[model samples]
Target: MSRAKGNLAEDKACKFLDENGFMIIERNFYSRFGEIDIIATKDEVLHFVEVKSGLDYESAIQNITPQKLSRLLRTGDVYMKKNSLDVDFMYDAIIVTPQDVELVDNITI
Candidate 1:
């Protein structure tokens, strides 16, 4: 997808998360490993969110391959260590489609 479209989806994802009571901490956090799309906190746990958009949920979700997940994990670790954070955290994904935005939490590698 184009960068513009990705940003739009991320903007929508941020709105969705904010409305759901998550406090947005950062966006596009980059490290040598990769980039994390969004970082938020809710109920004292940190969320590392990856925004994926497509015509449907399955198509969008499929974009998060194993290699991509590994990158996310490594980047998340870099984020925590760099910030000196020791809080609970989990990898997540936000699937944005024409119909709605969905959050899939606790994504595993």
Candidate 2:
């Protein structure tokens, strides 16, 4: 999607996360590896979130290809290292659709 659309989705995802008790620590963090859409914390665990939005769930979710996941993981590592953070963390995805937004935590393969 375009940059504007991506920003909008990330904004919505931030709102959703904030409402659900995730403190928004950062947004659009970048590194040599790639960019992390959102960095949030809840229950003492950091979440590196990827925000994907489309007309439906499948289209949005399919955007998170393996290459993308690899980039996210690498970037998350870079973030932790750069910040000297040794806390627990996990990769996550926020699926935004016209009807609703859902947060899938600990989205491991």
* Tens-digit per-residue lDDT, 4-108, candidate 1: 999999999999999999999999999999999999999999999999999999999999999999999999999999999999999999999999899998889
Candidates in order, TM-scores: namely: 0.98, 0.97
Question: Per-residue lDDT for 76 in model 1?
Answer: 97
Q: By lDDT, who's the top model here?
A: 1
Pull out the clashing pairs in model 1: none
Question: What is the lDDT, from 0 to 100, of the residue 45 in candidate 2?
Answer: 95
- Prediction 1 global C-alpha lDDT: 0.97
lDDT of 2 by residue, 1-109 (tens): 8999999899999999999999999999999888999999999999999999999999999999999999999999999999999999999999999999999887776
How much does candidate 2 score in TM-score?
0.97
